[model samples]
Structures are given as C-alpha cells and as structure tokens.
Target: MVRYFDAELETMPWTDVLAWQAERTATFVRGLVDRSPFHTEKLAGVGVPTGVVRDLAFLEDLPFTTKAEVRESQSTRDPALPLGRHQAVPRGAIHQVLSSSGTTGQPVLYGLTATDVEMWADVIATAFWTAGVRPDDIAGHLVGLPGVAGGLPYADGFRRIGAGLAWIGGWPTERVVELMISLGVDAVLATSSFGTYLTDRCEDLVGIPAKDIGVRKMLGGGEPGLGQPEIRQKIVEGWGLDVLSEIMGLGDVLACLWAECEDGGGMHFCGQRAVAVELVDPATGEPRAWEEGVRGEAVYTTFAREATPALRYRSRDHVLVTATSCACGRTSPRIRCVGRTDDMLIYKGMNVFPSSLRDVVLQGFADDVQPSIRVWKDGSDQVRFDGPIPMDVEASDDLAPDRYREVAAAIAADVRARLQVRVAVTVVAPGSMPRTAYKTPLVHVRETDDDQ
Candidate 1:
C-alpha cells in the first residue's frame, strides 16, 4: 500500500511542522498586509502588530474570518477584482476559479493561481495516499464536475499518484455501472450517500451484488455519515469494500484537507504545509487544547496561497480531535467531524447535534430501520424546540407493521437515554423516506414561510 505521498514532510516531527508552518504564515501575512485590502482592513481594525507574524500564537489575536465576510467581500467586490477583496493578486494571476456547493445560502467563489493549483494537487494526493490509494488502481470518479472544488481539482490529485481515472459522473446509473465493469475500476471516489446508493444501483443494473462487481475500495466524503457506525457498516457490507475511508474538506479553505488513513481510526490532517488548523470552542470561540477526545470547531488559516488566502478562517466545522499520533507514522493530528455549528440545536439547556441523534437511532435500531432518517422542523430557522423534537425514520423492508410500536418506543427510549434529549419518533413505511445520490440532509424543514 502507498504510505506517505511525501515521506520526508508527511513523517516530519509535529514540532518541526509547526515551526515550518509558522515561518510560512509569517511571510504570507506580511504579503497579505501589503496586497489584500480585506486582510489589511480587518487586521487594522483589530490593531494587529505591524510586521510579520512570528509565531502561531499570534493567530489568536487576529480576527476570525467568517463565511459572511467572504460572501460580502464577493458581493461588494471591485469590478477589477472579481474573486473578492480577498483576491490578493490580479485577475490575470488566477488560473482557475472554484465554488462551494451553496447548499446553505449563496455560493462563495475562490480563486486559484497556477501555483495554487499545483499545490492543491499535492495536498489532495497526500490525502488519497493516506487513504491507501496506489498508483495502479483505477478509480471511478462519481462526483459531478462543475465549478465546484471537488471537480477537476480532485481528479487531478488522484491522477498525480499514477492512478487511472474514469470521469463517469453525471452519466446514467446503468452507464456508470457499465464503465465500472469495462474499465476494471477497483476503487470509487464519491460522496458517502452516493456511494451507498450506488451499491443498490449497481446490483439492480447488473443483477448481482455490488461486491461481485470487482470494486474493492471506496473513498467517501462530502458528508459525515460514513463515520457513523451504522452507516459505515452499510457501505462496507453493500460494497464489500476492503478499503473504506472518508475524506473531508472546506471549499473556502482547501479540498480534501483531512483524510482517513488505512489504519482506520480517523482522518489525519493532510494540508499541514498549506493550512494551519486550530481547535476552538464553538460556543465561546476560545482556543481549545489539541488533546485526544477534545471536541471543538476547526479553524483554518491558509498560507502559501497566492490568489486568495484566508487568515484565521472560521470554518465552523466542528470536529473531535481523535489522536495526536497515529500508527501510520504521520505526525499531524487526527480528527472526525461531528457536525457543524450551524447545524447544532439547543434543547432544554443542552446542545444537540442531529447527526448524533441519527447515530443513536441507527446504532440502536439498525435492524428495524432502513438507515434513512430526518429530524422534522416546524420552521426553517427553528433551533430551540420546547417539545420532543420530531423525527421521521423509515422502516426497513423486512420490518413488520406490528413491531413498529416496539421499535419506535425502543428508539425513543434509547435516544433519550443516550443523548439526554427527547425525540418523538414517527416510523414510516419502507421506501417512504427520500434517499439521495448526493449529500443527505439530516434535518427536514416541515414548514417554511413560503409554504405557509
């Protein structure tokens, strides 16, 4: 198996990596102060010391860059600088422009210079390499290619390892399955939900189990369910995958920034040279210690980026630091994304995450339920629920109607017992709930102002 993409750097001491990143950040900050008006004004407002940032600790005093600020920067961008005020270089310097999925609100655009593109390839390749991808493997690329970061950037990174790539996204399901067979594709790159959905799709199309299709590996990302025990079991069993790993990235930062290693614990930080990561309390925004089992929001600052670099970017990606060291010999930390701060809810003086609730149900009642669930919301902006939070769960195909009450009661009890949150379980018939070939929504807004 491919171990480290760049062994010397990947296996470097954690202390040395920080020192290297600190110096790079210092130089980048000095350049940003001169070039980026956005960074300059923000830094000036906070009264940051005038000069190069000499250490990583200097980041704490810097103002956090939010998604709102980025959107505003883009919307109010000068005509000459279309990529936003964060655009440190001229438009001509940007060789490519990528965008976010915009599932939350308006999509944000990011610019990449020629150097940024080459660095991105190396970063993404390191992620894939950590996930056990080898040079000879033929990977079926299933994610849709558009203006999004996961498009050509990811494909280019995968090919950097001398792996064969089949761009089969946006094609019909049957056609995709056919190419997988003909091209001898042994690995698949896809969103977690899409990977699970394709397992059933391939079986239906070929009249055989997906495991028999010669695909032995799955690299799932774009969502968090793969880390859940129930979801992981489903994808592993359905695909008969020998190597199942999850990758995570932020569009505003870098693509495939964290990747799971073959040792199978959590994703290791893969963008160390390009990005500095910090753990901060989501509630207070205070810096959290990088100890194992500590949960906090992941904050990122991009250095060595030419076109658009973010300093102390508030990623809002809440994660659990899994380990400070790994058996894979990489010195960077490991993490598992629990949920986003935006997706978190407040209940009866306790903070709750919908993904955690789903994990409770799927882990406790995996046999009776289909692996599909959604928390029902009375309004789009609803966060605090006075009553038992409404949730809908789809029954598995073999689950009987008579056992619905038993299963539902057990699920409610288990959720309350485990998460200390009350949930009103509404078990629906099999196939009633929606399943997607993309990122799955954990919360379903039942009432919107427009609908009302």
Candidate 2:
C-alpha cells in the first residue's frame, strides 16, 4: 500500500496546489516588504507595488536573488542591522541559525523562526516518509557535524516523524558499521559518497559483507550518485539495501525539498506549497516550460517564510523535468539533476558533468573499479579543459597491477566512446583518493603545475 505523511497536501490537484502557492507567496511578500528592510529596499528599487501580489507573473519583475547577493548581505555588522537585512523577524524570534556547507565558497547564514523550524521538519519528514522510512524503524543518521546544514535538519526530521534515531555524527566508518550491526539499524541517512564509501569498506571493517549488515533502506542526498542508475545500483547491490532514495535540496534554500518515491521514479517535489520551482535555460536565462524531458536550470522562490525569504533564487542546478504523473499519486513535477552549472566542464562545445563520466565508467566496469574518483586538472582557476583530461580511477584492491592497467585503459576507451571526451585514466590502488563524511569533491585542480 502507498503511504504518505500528509496525503491531502501531497495528492492535491495541480489547480488547488497552485492556488495555495499563490496565496501564500503573496502574503509572504507583503510581510517581507513590511518587516525586512533589505527586501523592502530591493522591492522598491525594482518598482514592485507595495500590495499583495495577486499575479504570480509579478514575480518575474523582481530581480533574481543570487548567492553572491546573500553573501554580501552579511557585510554589515551593526547590532540593529543584525547578520543580514534578510531577516523578516526580530532576532529573539529566531529559534536557530544554520550555515551552508561552504563546499564551493564562503558559507552563507540562514535563520529559522519557530514556525520556520516546524515547516522545515514537516517537509523533511514528508520526504522521509515518501522514501519508505517509517516511524517504527531505527535509523542511523550519518552526515556532517551539527553546525553545517546537512546533518541537523535530517535529525530533526527523523525526530519529528517519531523514528528511533541514533546520533552518529563524526563517527568513523568502522564505528558506524559496528553501530549498524549492534543496533540492527533498519535505515541509514547519509550522503551518497559516504554511503558508497561505507559499503566499500564494510567487509574489511566488519566480519560480514555490507549487504549482510541488513540495512533495508539507504536515504542518500548531498550529491548526485543516487540519482544515477549505475551508481544507485552499486549502492543497492553493495549494501544489500531494498531501496535507495535520493533526497535533494540546496543548503541556501531548504534541505530535502525533493525526494524519490519507493517506485524508483524521479524525485517528487516535496516543497510544493511552500516553494515555487521554475526552470530556465542555463545558456540563455530564458524560462523553460515544465514539459516532459525538458532540461534547464532550477530556480526557487519561497511561498511562505519569515527569516531570509528568497525571491526567485537561482539554484544553478541543471535538471531534467518530467510532468508525467508518478505512480505514487503525488501530482508534483519530478526532476532528475543533470549537474550543477558551477561544476560543469565545457570541452569542445560539449558540456561534461564529472558525475556523468563516473556513472558511465561504473556502468561499464563495475567489478574492476572502485567508487573513488578524481578529475585532476593542472590549474586551479581553469574551468574548461581540452581533450585528454587527467583522471584518477581507484582499482579494486584484489586486482593485480597488470589487470589494473588493462582495466584503466578500457575505462578510458569506453568513456571516450560514450561521453565523447578524451580522458587519461590512471588506475590507482584502493584508498588512493580521500573520503569524507559529507559530500566528495569529484574535481580536484592543482594549485601549481609543479604539484602535478
């Protein structure tokens, strides 16, 4: 049987959903103009009328909010001004302040009121429930420490859903494995990279195979692996998990805003009423229709928020949209992230995502290759690369040196044929690349040529 945390909201018709979103968005914008000085100035500067926004078309008139703008908002330090003029509520009303992971650059700050926190939990819990996690299950939360955006919100979500939660932050892989065994954890919440890493090291750390550990579900996010078919299969086979659901969100916007259903289709938009999602052509910045198989960059706007409300925020995440109704009965549009614009590499007029390259390699050479990969470049500042880009592929530990070389050559040839990009693959021993408790950096550019 299909289960949903909030069936009435999740299964609402498209017309009613849009009506709810429109009403909530207008109210939020009016409150922003009245309470948030930063937004007040921005809206006035843009010549937006000081009234309820009846038409959603008026949102297009407002300037798109960028990460750079949010970062700049933190420059002022006056006590009355607070961290940023983005806060619509007084400081005392804010229940918590969270920071972005800062993987790409400087971390931005986000404040949440009591209501905002409750909404966040509700959305996250709904996502978890859709992904097949239940209240009776014991889940091991494996993510970064509390200060960053990834871990704490999931913990809160699990608690809100009345699940038995184990706080396993900062625990080593061996310790995590041990806890799973001892506690018989039914589900694990972790980044895709960490989940793959744990699966790779599971047999060595513990006496049994990773699949034997008996984790029924792996809830993965914070990166692209779970959405990719080959990578998802690897996790499913390696960990012996029944389902692998990819929950996606941006730290600047919200966590776990979209989640895959048990049917293994694309991730459903869990932020339907609270967040407005749009797609735009990355190259031309023109709005794209949300038709089936359409590809574009994702932009978000908060329909109702008190602290740090965003207006048409550009997410920079390129995605393929599917308007087909999901078998799970959620009417929200589904999306599969193609790649992030920031991480894209343009080569000879073709854009290549590093995750796509990794996925192709994994699909072709699952047995010979390890999940660890690094796309090495000579300079730190370079975004585009010519033919024959350097990459390090980790070979399985059991493979002999001669076999490793052959597998590496074959991988390079396969990637060239499939992705149409030249790659110089160097097969390294197991554990050659660094592993993290959080998201893994697929591309590593050297600071100096001498280092290469």
Candidate 3:
C-alpha cells in the first residue's frame, strides 16, 4: 500500500510543535515591521517598536490588522517592492512569486524564498497524500486560475510522491469531461461547487456517472461548499466517489490545508511545520480561546513560511477550533469551518449567515423552490422562495397569487420569527434564478420606491 501520508509531519509530537512555533514565531514577529511597509506604518501608528515580539503572548498586545489596510497600502506604494531591507532573501535565488491580486482589495505581493518554496512543496506533498496519490496514480488540476497559483504546488507535490500528472488546468465543462474520459484521471482538484455542476452536466454531455470515471478522491476548494454536508452528499451521490477532501485556504493553497484523514471527521491541520491560529469572536473580535462550541475568526501565523510569510493574518473565516484529540493518533490542530466572516450578511442588528439561509432553504424544500434572496444597500432585504405546495385553493386564481404569497410570507415569517428580522417576500416561478459553476452569490439587491 502507498504511504498515503507524510509520516514525518503528520506524526510529529505535539510538545515539539510548540517549541518549533515559538522559535519561528519569534523570528517572524521580529521581522514583520521591516518586511511589509504596511506593518511598518502600523507599528508607527501604535507607537510599538518593530523586532520586539519575542514570543506568542506579545502578538496579542499588537493591534489587529484588516484587509482594508492591505488594500490601501498596495494602492500608493512602489508597485513592486525593490530588493532592500524588506527583502526576505538575496535577489539572485528567488524562483517564483505567489501573490494575491487584491481581487477584493489592493493586491499585496508575497514572495516565496527558496526555503519557503521547498517547505511549500512538502506541505503540498502532505496534502495530496490524502488521495493516496503515488508514483502510479494520475492527478489533474481543473481550476488552476491566474492568481493563487495552485498548479505548481500540485505538480511539485505529485512529483515528490512520484505520481504522474495530466497537467490539465481547470477547463470548460465540455473539455473537462473529455479529458477525464480520455486520460483516465485518478484524482482531481477542483472547487466543490464546480464538481457537482460537472457531475450533473457530464451526464448530459456523456452518459457516465461522474463517480465511475476512475477518480478515487477529490481535493475541493475555492468556496464555502467544502464543509457543507448537504453539498458533500450531493457531490458523492452525483459523482459516486468515496473520498471528497475539503481544503480551505487563500489563493496560496500552500499556506494551509484542512485535509481529511482516513477517519470520517472534518479536516485536520499539520502541526509539524507551523500554524499559530487564534479563533476570535465574529462580533466582539476577541479570541474564543478554543471554546468548545463558539465561533471565531482565523488569525493565522505560519512559521514554516519564509518568502512573503504572514504573522497572524486574518483569514475572515469563522470556525470552532477543537482541542479534542483525534482518533487518527495525530496531535495536530483540527478546524471545522462553520461559516465565513465575509459571507455573513449584517442587516438591521441581527447577523444573517448565508450558510444558515442555505441550510434552511435546502431542508425546507423538496420541489423546485428556486431559493434566491435579494439584499439592498439601504439595509432592507427580500427573499424569493418557489416550491410546490399542497392544493389548498385550486378552483380560483385568487389562491394562485395568495398561495404563492402565503408561501413566501410563511418563509419570511419563519425567518423573521426565528432569525428575528423582517424580509419582503416575492414569489416566483420555478427555475427562475440562475446557477453558476461555482457557489451562487446573493446577487440581487432590492431597491425602494425612492431610489426607483
């Protein structure tokens, strides 16, 4: 049998992990101010000296940074940071740059020092071991986009494990189906939402269940569908694969991975290399202290990273960090994401989570209740729910509009009554809204009469 796991990283002792992170965190913290200009300004603002953080506790005293700050810095600074005091390594050895494009904000560049690159490869190698990828298995990456540069790590990981690859980036639906059919693909890395879309569409293009296409496992990412049990079941039912690994991280897939171990539990983190995560409250912004059942943000500090390394970067993700020991005999930290910091729609005082809305919609409807929601910038919201109902008043069209109205009203009432917020109800025909290859966004914004 293939090793299927990196014994060195996965089985490292927990005591040693603490020591390792302490040393690296100290070094990284000391360098943070000079490395990025944002941190330098931040240090100046707070009247705190750089290169002063000696350990983990010192991090808490530092002011928290946000995505908005990063964006502002990227706008005015030297477009490309020159090789100077900020440079992590000598100029001659830098091989590749894996930076965020600020699709959401101003793009900040994070370079990978040569050492950072090697560690990244090993981490990725650890990630792919989930698929039981060996020298013999064939792997493919379908959604290797322009930024985030996921293809390289995958290729490097595959090479490290002696696995063969098809080198096919994420393709159009039709092309994806043909390549899988042609190459006899063994493992695939694609977004979870796209996987389901491909499975459903593949049947129409070719009469084959996506599961029967020789893929043993899938590495899913790029959205919130990774940990959703409903979507997970759908992907399995549609594709027929046994293993669906959920990896949650930024564009730099190497930064982190929540790969499922042989056990059926949620994803597990590798503690051997480095990870200093502080799960903070979604509302109050305080560390949850690994509370058993509370949600918080993920502030990550990866000590193993050298090039463009981060110290306590806020991932804008919410989850309950568990200290419960895993049955897999690995003492590494484990995280189960409950929702996203950005995904939550805050209107009128109450926080409405998209995952909560999705769960309610999915469980409450069996028919084509094309569930769609509309939110307004003015802080008002509406929901359009379309599902078949019982025959209460079949004889008159009064019942038609009223029944539809009642259904929408009932959902609105249920949400208001339960979630404690009011929402306008608009009923529509089945198959009204559009679905995308990836997770659907809440695209509609309701406008009031004054604006219209």
- Candidate 2 lDDT over residue span 63-157, tens digit each: 78888888888777757546587777878887878888786688888887788878888888988998878888899888747856667778888
TM-score of model 2 vs. true structure: 0.91
Q: What TM-scores do the predictions have?
A: 0.95, 0.91, 0.80
User: Which residue pairs collide, candidate 1?
Assistant: none
User: What's the count of clashing pairs in each model shown?
Assistant: 0, 0, 6
Q: Higher lDDT: candidate 2 or 3? A: 2
lDDT of each: 0.85, 0.80, 0.59
TM-score of 1: 0.95
lDDT tens digits, residue span 1-452, model 3: 74436676566665555555666676666666676556666656443334544345555766665655544544553424542223445445566765663444445555666677677767777766753456777777675553455656557767776777777675667677678768988778777767767665666667777877777777776666655565677777777776778766563325446666666456667534655666666666676664445567877776666555555667777775655456776666666776665556654656766666554544454232432333333332332222221111111212354467666666666666666655555656433444466555543444669778
Model number with the top lDDT: 1
Q: For candidate 3, what's the RMSD?
A: 5.9
Model 1 ranges with Cα > 4 A deviation? 45-55, 447-452
Best by TM-score: 1
In model 3, pairs of residues that clash are: 113-307, 135-162, 142-170, 143-170, 211-239, 369-386
Candidate 1, residues 59-125: lDDT per residue as tens digits? 7887888999989999874888998888899888989999988977899999999999898999999
lDDT of 1: 0.85
